[model samples]
Target chain A: MKLFFLLTIFFSFVPILYAQVDTTTLQNNLYDILEDATTDKEGVEYYDLVEYLVQNKIAVNTASIAELMKIPNIDRQSAIAIVRQRNLLGGIKNENDLRSAEGVSEELIDRIISYLIFGDVKDVSFFDSINKNFKAIDFTLRSRGIYDLQQDKAFSDGKYYGSSWKIYNRFVVSKDKNIRVGVLIEKDPGEKSFNDFTTFHFYARDIGFIKNFVAGDFLFEFGHGLTLWSRYSISKGIETVGILPRNGKGIIPYLSSDENMSLRGAAVQFSFNNFNFYTFYSVRNLDGSIDKSTNQITSIRLDGLHRDSSEVAHQRIVNEKLLGISADYSFGEIGSVGLLYYNSTFENDFQHNSLLDPSGNSFDYFAGSYSFTFGKLYFSGETAYNKISLATINSAEIAVDKNFSLLFSYRNYPYDYWSLHSNGFGEKDGTQNESGFYSGFKWRTSYGNIYFYYDQFKYPIGDEKLPLAIKGNEFLIYYSVKPFRDTEFRLRYTNQLKESVAAINGEYGVLSRRKDNLRTELLYKLSKFIQMRSRIELVKTYATAISSEEKGLLLFQDVKYAPTASLSFSGRIVFFQTDSYDSRVYEFENDLTGVMSNPALYGDGMRWYLVARYNTSFGLSLSMKYSELIKPNEKTMGSGDTLINRNVDNRLSFQLDFKF
Target chain B: MNLTIYQLYFWLGADLKFVKDLVFSAAVKKEIGFNPSIRLGTEYSMVDFFKLRIGTSNEPNTYSGGIGIIYQFVQVDYAFFSHPDLGLTHQFGLIIRFTKN
Candidate 1:
């Protein structure tokens, strides 16, 4: 295997050429401020709660307010104004006293003041709290490997079956305030089972009243998710109003290595004093496409690519079952309420060849939620229903203070609301037959912040291109600035129109298209080890009898270096041009570390990537990335089994993060 | 014509109590196309357990080092930088001071 991948990169650089490692410059700039607040397939549960507060820190003078809302942009009115300014200034002493609390800002204490810390809160004994819960047990082993060098046509017609590299592995054992266990394995690159997917889980927390407990896999969200949610959700970004409510941290613990969003069996939660309860049960084995003399099941393969032989005969071929329950109440400050129920089933039977599919074997859901905070306004909401087609959703949020906030949502679904874990707040993709009305806002000023939104949707059974019943509307605006103190700048604009079904004059009607976008960005911190970023984007599209107009442009530049402090480096150089792909453009990069890439700049050449990280004072940490995507007049690059031959496309990845 | 001089020092080392001594630096370049860069660094500490550093830099040349450690309130650091034609670079950091008044 290529000399065992060069002897595993020479014994992983022989322990970084002989020991010497330790890094944390505030958890590597808080993972570059949560990777610039996520994008591109968002959701990493805010980088897993800032990597568990950079390996357990918090304690800004004795935290609490649920430990400052577990960090990410602290909301709950900035964790009740940072515990009411640490009890009226008798504490807090840094990050300018959390920028003098009160709705805290200054980019939220500069992205959580490096995982916080600020003194006094010790005292523990009983074998030092069981040796700090056995040193908060944590064991991680991550591996990533990738290599792709041209040659396409499904590996020259051999229809690939393996080899071309791409492997991933994960193993975790947690215990930082509870307990967790994980395992994941993957193989792709023509998959031929070098372990083509495997996952495992076990979790526990606050055992007394059983506040949480899981077994062999999990994930389930309630309220606000429209019915049931699995797999981190967060749509719309840039903290537009601190993520418009939806603090549903119900039954979690499914360390992503996504091979079909969680749920395998067992789940629990319970509490007494202010009432809380939850329940779950699951059974899975999906990856469908049945239909052999009507055993039904046609379709239901969420990308877990099994590579050849009809995707390995549609792997597992259907079998799913789920059940849930929930209840909650807490009238502490005149708020908190919830109720939920869920059900799902399937073994086969679900074959609807068109007419907008959606034939079933069972499904049900119901929901209600609320959250409040009166004086100074703060409210939250959720309302779901979907007893096979009664589909509905209603969301609300208001924040009226600390610089304005508002959000309003409405959904209808219908068109036979079928559920497979509906993720709501829709515009389609599993929230059934669409129906919408959204409104968003955030103001805050004194040099930065202003977000806006407007949405209006429809699609009541519209298929094969507007067979009638379609509508759309959208608008977005953003503006941000700092202009100083480590610099920052932003500007955004968007407008959408939707409604499609082309081919007039030859039949097939429904028009309206119209997209528009404009963006600008800048971030600077040319010191403390240099950092810089720049971006410019533009996209335009119009269609309705195709009257010309289609444009796209992208620009990028980034550089990051950490001359010392255990060396760091980052690089980017992109330039895009689009006159098609309906004016494509997307940007978000800086990978390796739970990798994610945005790349979607159409046509005209130029792309780049270079990343490096190293830390090995024996507790391994290695990263390497190299990317390329040129296009000097395309020559086949992605189609079918991910085609690629010439027209340049390159990738090389290697990652390892081990800590003991 | 270009000239540069820089110096900084701080000491307390009675077996490293704390330190940050760049001490002295000099650079000279008679521009024709400019290529004059130089640097040097140093650090040492005690109170919080450990820290050690070293540095070197020159226009298209480089060399660097780092180390830091502390336990019971965790802290970790690592560094490495070397380039003569773009190569070596590494970094890692972690800190956790969960209270100490």
Candidate 2:
């Protein structure tokens, strides 16, 4: 016992005695050295001198972004970057180590070496190495329901109501400060539907190089709703209507968001004079079985009701190739401008079977856009021009989109082909023109936005037999109110009038059509994890072509719930109604009878669905959806009678994406 | 995570500013930037006759690639991203890394 106590006592006193040892002598010496170094440079800036010492291997300290900026030739942004990197690294060990820092340059290191010192002491740990890089595998799956509800619901008439599912996977590899690589794959599964899956165009969309040269299908964007882009698929309902040009299907070397399912092509981009230039080319080929209509106007029956393949073999068509080029220039504070041009040829599988041009047609298209910022306001504009055969039309728009700015626009479209008279006896010869003028005012605040607008449009036809003269004026009022960060209430009321003008024969043109619509929507984002949305629309239309005036209502609601960072659930409901025989005008039906007769006149209907999605850090995601569609009944079709039909569709999809 | 190497001088010396203001008894404002100083660094004494370097400061990072008459630093790297529908997304870039003394 006595020996143990004495040993403890001795150890305790040893620490005290060691601590008591006179460090004053060493401190005095250090003071003397510091005093001398300071006297060597008195008038110079402290930071400048600090860099000098650091360069000379004198002192070491964890430098902040602000501290880095004090060095010559470094900018504020670079300084901030250095600070962020320092945090990421925990702390730099020495001045030379700063080379690995984001903004540190070797030249700056050499220049500052004359004065810097590496004397700071620090601790190191194993965890530091683990944070240097990241690598992971990602996957995604998605399913969608595609349908046109405006067709008749009779079994004799074929209308496609089905769902499509796709699967995707991606693998990513990341190493050391600035290098990464990824690989991905995708496939789609077709579901049973009235329309057979004969032409499912599936191809590798984005397998290529990043940053320098890309050799695969990739998403690209060049202008404000112009040129080409991938995310245009999820456009609004207005965009769904032919009032606007449909987004093209192709790929090119361009800038865009949403990498999945886009155009395919090989492209290269380079930077010069602070501007980036890019170009790309894409190839496409489509072939499928064709179903012929027995009659042009009546008794058109579609076959292959249960067959997976087409009954008739159509002519083989050569591959259709499209080529496009784009260039963009960006200068800080000055804004950006981009231009694009594309050309493609349309071909027919049959040499002389088509009623129209059997050789098909080709069009040359060009688009240009520019965006600039002045103070708190932004100005943007774009123009798209297409030349078809002997006719050319230019569509241009300019928007001064600023806080509380007014917008005005004008459009003119001339149809040179309208001069071709196909009275069934001979070719009709006359030109038709469509023109419009629009002006609007918008008031925007942090909470919401309010807009009011007026638009006038006119269509003039020169053919005496085609008595086509129509004038239209419309007034719109729209507003969205946000009570909270993620919640909004929106309302839109549109009043429109259509008046018949003088016919080619100078007789009073008959009033063709008139329509009005009111729409209301509510969107509530409870948080980043949950959201709910609801919309209601009502329409009333009058037309001399139909016996009765038509009125319809549509209601839709959806809820999205995200329980975790990578998983989401969504459910939707819809109910709609419209005239059964007016599919050519207001396709608001469940079946696609009208669409079968004229695909251009897509029918309308109501649908409900539920979907689930999962996403991973490595750029992978998956989704599954089940949808029920309601259509009109065609089994007992009669004049002015409504059709009722129902369809259930189930789809599964998976996707994987990786960014190198 | 940081790995830095440097040296310091432990000697008494008067800076130019201190000497100039000595008569006025003005407070010495210590400077922090590069000052003229002699430095010793690790070098391959047996292999080189002599090595001289010229550089400018670009702040946080510096422009540092060098053209070496007897020594050279070069690197090549390639990266790729693969997709099921699309084949391979790839990038090829070369970096010529160098240091001078």
Candidate 3:
């Protein structure tokens, strides 16, 4: 039954899958930065900000500090220095002028220059621009389909309601810089309805006193995300020092195809003088498994798949309500301070099946944060308190010299602290019982740029494996150098040691494992149209109880060809060998322009992918991607519903973009 | 024969520039799979600086899209894909290129 349902949904969308485009490596560099910050569990949310900056090219000469801060890698101190330098030199005449700013490092300037334009801001007003151009109203449509070759249980048993294809579509309408309205629909394999999931939103920004407003669906981030952050938060990454401080944009419209993790209703922001205020309310239906006898929610379904009868039965079993308010005060060039409060209530109480589960139907959170900069030193911190516990995070960044910088951060989150929407700075998702201290430094020498950090953390109540309180420490060192124009080299090494519970002599005992990772990459622009990248990575794991050590190795070659502005293609071939999943290696891949794919290669395999994009004209673009993994020793691939019949697993995807 | 899965997608789009720097665009897309879905979207770019985008689709019946900025060699795209029965997904992408002549 479930297989039939899945097939029905898959076949329904098959007619439109022809002539789809291939993926492109347009944002490979950005993904490189984000991939460093991502973990196996948490997602990344910086894509929107990068897109905004790309389309609205920041006018470096006239941009405000806030605008400068929107660019990645630009810290508060760097923004201030850029503004001061611009004022002192009358204005930035070119990228070179901005690069010479005090407190600005060569690496920072190189990272931000592409997103900025050194010129006067456009003279046309938002309304005037739209009025003069009837084309100022834009529309876009996109569709994607994915299918697996291997037949799973649902497929073999004919339990899927839809075909094996996963179909997705999106439509949008907008008025330049004024109003936007959008809709999205998707159906996964084995799902019953062609449009099993749908979303709509209308948003407006930068009009009169209303800074921004969203109706339908939206997300917000405030302070360090301890109180109200409805999206992914960076816990740790290669940037090492600069990303410790959270830069929250009060309220923004939500736009994505993810089936979970946002609010429905309305949100609005207003500004008066140096003070800005935002408030939002949302009521949303969530998928979850419920205890029939207790009338309580046993587990929430975040994957948003309803292919089978049991999954469909669990759909929309819980109703959630959220309310939040925030106020921020900016003190000109000195810094800013903000306060946030959020409350969430569920229709059904969350019944705790395990000690780690949170109970009750309502949860409230309060938090405050402040950031200040004085010359070459900057400080920022946030403290959040919930009904049961408190979480605090603080950081200090200092520019020791033009060639060196240092960053330090401390976080303490009590075990009982609970915030459903909190994604604070911690080793795990959400701000719960975890405490850590981190310090990092960056140095730019004539040979290369060096970055390193050390973090020490502990869990008070123990985790899934360790039945007793556990302590862990991690350290990373990274070095990068541009040997020549359009050529670069990078090396990184990381070591992590953590405690876990293990069975010893038929008795449970605490054991610690030390994992070390080393990676080296080289990128070269062979020509104006051809580029190549090569990487080699190694991982080793040593258990305290066992004398033997496990090791893993991965090597890959990447090539990109962009013969013309209208067409480009990239491909990667990877070979990996590992003793076990414990020694797995993670590598980021080039996917669709907006999509990110970084699969962890384990159990010895050969993986490869090809992505290509073609812009037929100024208004039409198409992209497609094909990827496959082969593990000769393994008979079954994947787990659960995604399991494949053979040792080889593969997928194909295509997308199209039309502007005019 | 090797086990193979074939997927297909179709899209139609149009863009108009009424002013020197202002532009408008619209598009429709469809995909075939176990469940077929259709999407519609429109966007407006003001003075080649900022762009606002809106879109809707039927399958799960969700609304999504975002705003973006395109300047010279850099483009920043932000999107919000939401689902009525589920939650929302927000994504941001940045692209930088040094075109060689």
Candidate 4:
């Protein structure tokens, strides 16, 4: 019985220990409150008394003895007495009400009222006026300065210093209503004087009906993002996770948090009987400096999705004022199918076409994919086809692709989501786009993963006269394992072959190259706030007779340290052996109409850079980078110097981001 | 003093933004200086996230401003400034902070 009583005592003490207060901070706040009430004098520190009162509304009535003691002037004995009195006499309602309560006085109320407030008190109407409803706003800012160095080599070789800043804001106007806005600014120090700005606007549940709208710059995701899409900061540009491009400033509907696909302009959506329908009309008008090109055409997109009894539905859409319609459907035990059609007039001619005549073209496409689980095995396959052409050409180009994937495993839950996709998959942000069968399967233990995969991409030229055609295939086998809680290691080998078509002697010729790439990486978490990562990439490429040897090894290391909730520091180093630039200039006849030839040389070189960056919650970031481009055993171009040199370059930048 | 602090920050940063406004005054004045104004501005973000904001400080105060966005401790804020004639006379700026969600 004594042991049981002692155990209970220990447990009760744990709660007491956790509830301790910092007396110093309490005393400071008390002094601050007293000082503010007594003096409106300048130089006397002015804490946000109003905001502080609003923030601590609930603690006044429900605070524990420890919590009460934390309030500036309240001692432990007074705190306990106040609690006891409050329990006996309900709770104090107002300043005057507190004056009559036991252990409370008018003078004490006067002193504390300056610093604290109770949110539920309704006797006075002033607090109600000040805080009609709760609302929040959030933002990011960036600024960059640029200094131009050398520009002889396509400006790509120029030494430039730059910086950027951005601020994003989200306003929760109410429980169901929200407004989001953001601004971005950029400065290019390398360019002498250039600045950029971007802004965003958003409204969720805008009409109180079953509708939502977001305007400004946002992303849009159509079917798997193959055609229309958007993705944002969270993930790198990889197709496996099904994200599209991250666009900006447009109005869109809110489907869910995962519905990051946003469009600019006016969007309206309605849901009826398990079927959802949406339509949006958008205008593309923004500052031109951000991107060199602009879209002048007005666009309209419509979508309809439905499912029987179940909430899942098939989807369809028609987009762009000129483009017609597209449709998509899916069902359990069946398959998912998509069809798209578009017809539009071209505003610009490629070369010989007459601008007055205008080319009207139509494209038809179809995509189908299916997946199912069989005991411990899963199988899936997808196929797509597209036919596009100009009516004037009288001939349409067609392209088709198909893929099938299969996996077998035990039912004992042997893997996590990331591991089941093999180590090839990066982070998942719900917006990732899936191309084809990209990953195999694997098992996961505390030690990480064992896996294999094959990836292939082909950009086939439907028109034989087109200037570019690329086909690439990659095969890989890798293992990723974390032997300990804080360490992660990955070892992988990949063999890739690429083929491109180029015009030679007025005829299309194929140039094929193969490379064996070996990669390894290790990430170690030294502590909760510090992490270290190191990686190496080795590439060996063969180009038959011209050059049998073209190989290089790249090494990179990065250390990230976060000492507090608002600040982080990172340092990275990248070193690689630069390839030699072939001084020989090749002239290629125009593939279309076999016109006059143009000559260009592929430069061979190496580059190395190191960058250190610091980020803070106060809307500021700073970075410094030093880079060098080197040419070894040079070859001259014409009568110029042995090699156009790029010496060591240094750049430093700072940015601040916030929202209002 | 606030205006002075703001201008000093911009000058030390060597911000080169151009502005068009310098003063904004309402037809009437009360216990609180409350008014509405329209502003057109341009700004740039540095590589790491610093901002150089240049624009109309007011209808009459065209002061260049240095701005930064800070998001730490789950709170976000923007630091910016306008002209002294409107209020802070030389060093006063605006710091707006809030939580979005």
Q: How well is candidate 2 docked (DockQ)?
A: 0.00
Task: Give the TM-score ranking, best first.
Answer: 3, 2, 4, 1
Best by TM-score: 3
lDDT of 3 by residue, A435-469 (tens): 99999998999999999999999888676555478
DockQ of each: 0.01, 0.00, 0.01, 0.01
Tens digits of per-residue lDDT, candidate 4, A1-660, equal 000000010111222111111112332233323321211121111122222233334345655443353343432223444666666667655555555555443334554554444435432222342345444333333333333233323233333222121111222222312333433322222222232222345544424344345555433333322233333221211111111111111123221111113344555444342223444544332111111153221221111111121111111112222222343343322223333333322232212132111122232333332333233232333222333211100001011111111232111111111100011111222211111223343333445555454555444331245435455666666667766667777776767676656555577666666777677766667678666655655667775434456655444445566666554454443434424322222211110010111222223323333334454556454544333333232332222311223332333333333322
Tens digits of per-residue lDDT, candidate 1, A402-514, equal 67778776777776666777676565568777888887888878867788888889887667555578788877888887756776778888788888777788888777888
lDDT of 1 at A229: 74
What ordering of candidates by DockQ runs from best to worst? 1, 3, 4, 2
Q: What is the C-alpha lDDT of each candidate?
A: 0.68, 0.38, 0.75, 0.34
> Model 2, A1-660: lDDT tens per residue?
010000010111222110001111222122212221211212112221232224223223544332343342332333444555556766556664666765444433544444333445432222332343234222222222333232334322442222232223333332321222333333222224322222111212111322234555444554533334433222112211111221121222222112222345565655465455666665543333322442111111222122122322321223445567777675444455777777655443323342221223454557776655454333444555554422222222222322354545454445433211110000111112555666666566676666676777776552344446667777777777866556567787766666554333455555656677787766666566666665656677776644448765555555567677677666655545555333222212111100001011112343445555566686544444444443322222122312433232222222232233
**Model 3 vs. true fold: TM:** 0.81
Which candidate do you rate higher for lDDT, 1 or 3? 3
TM-score of chain A of each: 0.30, 0.50, 0.92, 0.50
Worst 10 residues of 2 chain A by lDDT: A1-10
Better of 2 and 4 by lDDT: 2
Candidate 4, after superposition: displacement of residue A575 in Å?
2.6
